[model samples]
Target: MRNAGLGSWPHRRARMAPKREAFSYDGVSTTYEEVAVRTTKLARRLEELGVRPGDRVSYLGANHPSFAETMFATHQLGAIFVPLNFRLSPAEINYQLADCGARVLIHAPSHQVEHERAISLDSYEDWLAGGSEEPLDVPVTIDEPALILYTSGTTGRPKGAVLSHANLLWNTFNLMIGVDVTTDDIALVAAPLFHVAALTQTLLPTFIKGGHSVITPRWDVDECLNLIEGYGVTWMFGVSTMYADLAASPRWPTADLSALRVLLCGGASVPDAVIHTYQERGLVFCQGYGLTETAPGATFLEAADSVRKAGSAGTPVFFTDVRLADTGEIEVQGPNVTPGYWNDPVATAAAFTEDGWFRTGDIGRLDDGHLYVVDRLKDMFISGGENVYPAEVENAITDHPDVAEVAVVGVPDERWGEVGRAFVRPRAGAAVDAAGLREFLLPRLAKYKIPVHVEVVTELPRTGSGKVLKPALRRLPLAPAVSPENAPGR
Candidate 1:
């Protein structure tokens, strides 16, 4: 009596607001009715391409209307959607495609030459011309796999986190209630749709409410401002770094961002300065925390707490149950949590406890039910038997006016088992000296927690998701103590 597959959401949405604008990009708008109709034709075309129920349909392209359309179409046939990051190398993309044993590949025209297995998004018209627009009567249920989103896997080889239709739906509901998404909301999908946050938090919830969404191939501050003013975007989600970049934009002050009611910040802990900047513009920057395994909506610092609990990731979402493990690693139990990695039982078993609670790998604590994220357990270091969390060190280091970005890593030391090394990126037109930074941190953090060695870099290497790659940082040679700040900016 119940149809839980995500494929049915668009059909249901069309009934509520057929003529409503469902999506827009690069001046083209598609209504709910149009999406419903086109998705069926696209589904039929995919069927013709031999994608069957439970088979994987991969998309390797930048954000586009066709990407969303293809996703829903795959859902229509009870197939799983695999959206590859366009920024990844072809080898990386091909690894996922083959790992999932994808039935077919749909990619942007520009990437088609690099991936011969993929059919260009431009060829959709020709492919669908002869296909029938019949709705598939597949037996896909809410508990079945809906998507296979690969984690950044800085800790190990990238593993596909299998998210079910139920996981996606539950997460959407959790965010809608926690984030206060409304039917009139126009959400901007600025982050890569391949990630769960931009899709589950922004796109899915808005779709269910018959709201509007704008997709972009990449994140651009100027174009984002244009969309906010032009489309009347009421909500958006970005990493703390992205928010800082926008605050630095020349047009940010006068950009008519009055329509933006909620700004969701995640991926990393936002600095107090970035929060204050948006508050000046009359907006509440909601900070959140989650992983791909949790469908990405585990916690959200409410608008009211944006200032009150500036550094916290906030309370757990409605359905998520969060607790601290004996070792301080965050553990979560919820319907939104992923079942496990695809086809890797050993890894899956290792991810959860015997009682089935998923270990988050990141060390954190709860204060009155509000979660405060510490650094990753693997990234934590022991200096002469004392625990050193990198996040705490980074927070203290960035407090200096000259510091722009910073990453702390633990390296092997002969005296101590491991020691902290600080890499600082100075703000533009600003200068920071190791001697000055050492004096600055002396007051902010415990002497033992301070990095033994300090170095300056123009920029820190980051993953596509905006995570600092500590592994890459570890590869750089470290000096005995203070290395003079690299004054030359890249």
Candidate 2:
């Protein structure tokens, strides 16, 4: 085998488990042998199109078997795979295409992306049919880059995080140790595959373990619930919102979810109400925390620790090193950590410490041998000379039965330097009010820590990655502060 990267996996798994099911999508199942054959043919076709080693190949679409096949095929030719968020506009999509200098753009018909060399997934089968089925044994090393995942760009422009084969492999190894993925596992990939949480955490690990992956193009609460029972899915990955929607679904109370073994949640902290909903159904969530640069798996809280250490991000993965700086910023160093950003030396240099640890730009604290992520370093606000983390407050507020989602930001205050303002979304039919929310928080939070102002909104602006767009929230018109001393009920 000339390839020492992920390109070798398909063929290796084919030999080990030729008849084992690898992926299931839209009622069609593919075996390891079949996947390997498709991968080889696709690699040959890509090579014929002049995709050389070190060339960038981009994929734009939702969750599909083609996503996995294209990733493996691109790696098979020793090229890098860049998965774009389909939700992005044509302009944003083109910006990423040009940023990566992608040689070929393989996209779905739904996306209106423009590129010089584009291959529509509509003609994907015909494209592969023309290429021979012979194996492509490209000489790829562990240090060679495999993926260029872009950050969410909440504040500034998104930077491409270059992850090597080693980084991804070590991340998978860490996940195997942390979650114990097995061959009998059937993972439901309901989340978008473009995100590292779904790709590196669920899809790749399941593939490495020879487990079957059931991919849904996009998330639909009812469809996911039905697929979990129909396919007997053992495990799956999702964000906080996805889990919340599942719990809110009408079928949730009677859905036959006995086949589900574990549900992995990340992208944000899971609220106490959401966790309790799943717990009441005899299922526990395994929460994780990381960035795209860390191959997305720095820490994972096992199901056993979900209750005792509810809000903690858990300890670092087996192969990662995690520590807090003097300023409470989380620093990570490990094989799974990315080397640097792609083609941006200035950003790359600034991303790491002088001694080489990647500065996570996230504030965290260590307690009881676990890491609790407080908030983004820049997101923390000082209220009345006291520091407050929005995540901590949001977590507490979402615990209210009527509250579905909440985002807190520091609004300018005349009394205090800056006070917290909560933008809350109530449950579907609930009539939750700012006064009721304030009363609910009276016992749960300190007087100074509670939001001085609250606004009930139908929705909060969010980024493509499901993170609340705090900047947008900050731009909204501010209301006069309601001081704790002179508030309506205080």
Candidate 3:
């Protein structure tokens, strides 16, 4: 039988050790039995709110124990859980809610006022007060949809990816065997639970292992360090930017990270220098690559291969097939793959190939079984008839000694059709100029591949998960285009 819900997982854990801690946040802790009771009550509350089986229930909140409880509760009733990005604007959240045809929205009190209309779970005591605590009859099949995660929509409007219970369960089990998670493990969940990266890599795996989860309210570097020490956090997941901030934080080096056994970084590529910095400190750093469509974990560079693979996103997880199309697009197929986009039949049809492989818009190449991401296919542009991948130029620029961060995008060019433009954040206490950057990258990149313009900024605009918002960058007013000789491009 497939293990997909609390009914089976909780019963198995209760027989093994019901008293063991299953989750912790702030000072509150919940065991398997406690989780079961709360979820049962919440399920009843959801039913009282008129949420029937297969109905979409939206959640707009930060990462907390309640979020996980609510997700499980929704699952118990065979309802689809749509966790909205807490950082998105109300309109963005509303778009997703309406797109999914959500029947009810359960939000935390902190975010209740922010949402135009939402039922606060913090005030749910009154609602559940009169409701029954008995578990709702769960008729969930392995193939039933469980989650509707909206993509970041970097290229266009976001699309909700529908993930089945089997997709999550199988992915969680795959992560367990691939990462070797144990019951004694305590996972530090710093990434937003709304993202599939956190949900699949940390939350689901922790529950499946009967392990403890330390939920952080937000991603504060010092607070994250403190939580690691406070809860004896054994494993954690963060993006490359988070790791960079943590490594450069004042609390690091002095902070006791001895309890940490693994640190997974992804959502974007990691700098080689950053990887070396962690290795020099005896930290195990692994990198992974996936999209919301793949239940967020298609490939993972194991700790053992971290140094060897360097910048690779590692091999595909068990049962997942990762292939590079002849056109250089990444294609994925497996049980973990999402069924399709919600209410987007045209997009759903366009997303898959003739044989059913999902065409990931990413451009990548395989070197001895390891995936090296070149860039996003959509992010690539032709400059002076030469193909320019923004990620490549951005990576090169970020590697500069005085550069702290960078983003590369193509701008409308009346002469060349399009030209590469770079926005950079220089390291503190260091001096960097556009001319100097041009000189720095001139030898490292092709003549046409070098950015035609460079702008220094305090920081690049990013999503909550640290992905560079190139669309926002594109909206900025045009700057003077520079040529290879440090003059106007022309």
Candidate 4:
């Protein structure tokens, strides 16, 4: 009972609700008592593998019960857990494994990591069964590092954000207070748990409440819809794109969604159309705004205020404090915020202010007690002496029925210092010409704010967390300035 970190949660939950279902995957369910036993066995195995205090144990796989088990086991031995994005290439994964100096790596089948002991998830059962489940009560502290999550490296190399046990616990408290996850909740975890939002924002809080979680390895529109109806899911978390896909599904009109009580959305702004689509079905989204550094729960837009503050990210969470710099950059200070980046002293120093607040590089606005994230400060550009935020323009463009997705970036212009160029992916069977997009924007945005050029694309590149890779879009070759009538075809 000396463990004060996340590793202690499994046993704690088992003591309180031993028979309650903890998590389910692929039609199999595990109880809290079972999870605690497995966690102890895994911890002992890891300890035998030379994983000591402060050592790192990395996990590379999809959303499975083993992920949570490995994380708990790692922390139980007073070691740091590093969860790698399975979507990344082997080279990328190797960099993170080396960067963190991982002692052991638990990965899915066919995935390889150059570590001393690489344990495949296929053999995870055998691995767990071999270890003796004798009691392991390592003395750990709340401030000790629990996770090292890597940032989506859009600009340069990805840096690991070191989150302490206190940060994770505070974030869980904030989410519980803001969204109300109860013991009766049946949560659907469709997002990848490797991402901070899915892990801390969705799974951890539900686990703490002793709620049941239906975990999926990957997202499939029909599969998710079926799980919701079959399991009578009461709570779920997803990004804007996932929600949009669900709403666009053929069965959306007749799908059984009456059991769903809470839908938490984040990672990007939810288009007004997507919001209306769900509202017409008698469901309201509880949208939040945050980054991995803040344990990913800085603000929450309660379902009650969702309609009133349509585009706002909502107010700061219960324990987090948010402030906007004169330049509109969002700064956060709270127990939930990460202490700093792993092994990068220079980047850590640059990420925080002299006084201690973490500088979230993104720009935002405070209005009527709500926070509206305008755009990334680096993403904004001045066009003809007027500052332009792509998110504002993108939101306006998404209103067009033909558009499925769009990304705007500033390209060098001959007349203006810089001009907005939009890359749009049209909805199925929609032509979505540049002229029509311009005509649609004419009434919605200022002349300066509208994208000067539009190009129809088949798909937009996105990160594993469902965020648009703007840097990739900026790297694309600029198409010629075409007249609306002569716009290129998709």
Per-prediction TM-score to the true structure, in the order listed: 0.79, 0.79, 0.77, 0.80
Count clashes in each candidate, considering only residues at least 3 apart in sequence or on different chains.
Answer: 0, 0, 0, 0
Runs off by more than 4 Å, candidate 3: 1-12, 112-117, 380-490
Best by lDDT: 4
What alpha-carbon RMSD in Å does predicted model 3 have with respect to the real structure? 11.5
Q: Candidate 4's error at 86, in angstroms?
A: 0.5
lDDT (10s digit) by residue, model 3, range 126-213: 7656667765566668898889988644333667889988888878866876787999999999888987888889978988788999
Q: Provide the lDDT at 227 for model 4.
A: 95
Off by over 4 Å in 1: 1-3, 113-117, 380-490
Better of 1 and 2 by lDDT: 2
Q: What CA RMSD would you report for each candidate?
A: 11.1, 11.5, 11.5, 11.1
Q: Write the per-residue lDDT of candidate 4 for residues 144-240, one digit (tens) a residue.
A: 9999998634343668999999999999999998887898899999888988988998899999999999999988999999999999999899877
Whole-model lDDT, model 4: 0.86
- TM-score of candidate 4 to 2 decimals: 0.80
Rank all candidate structures by their TM-score, best first, as comma-separated numbers: 4, 2, 1, 3
Score candidate 2 by lDDT: 0.85
Ranking by lDDT: 4, 2, 1, 3
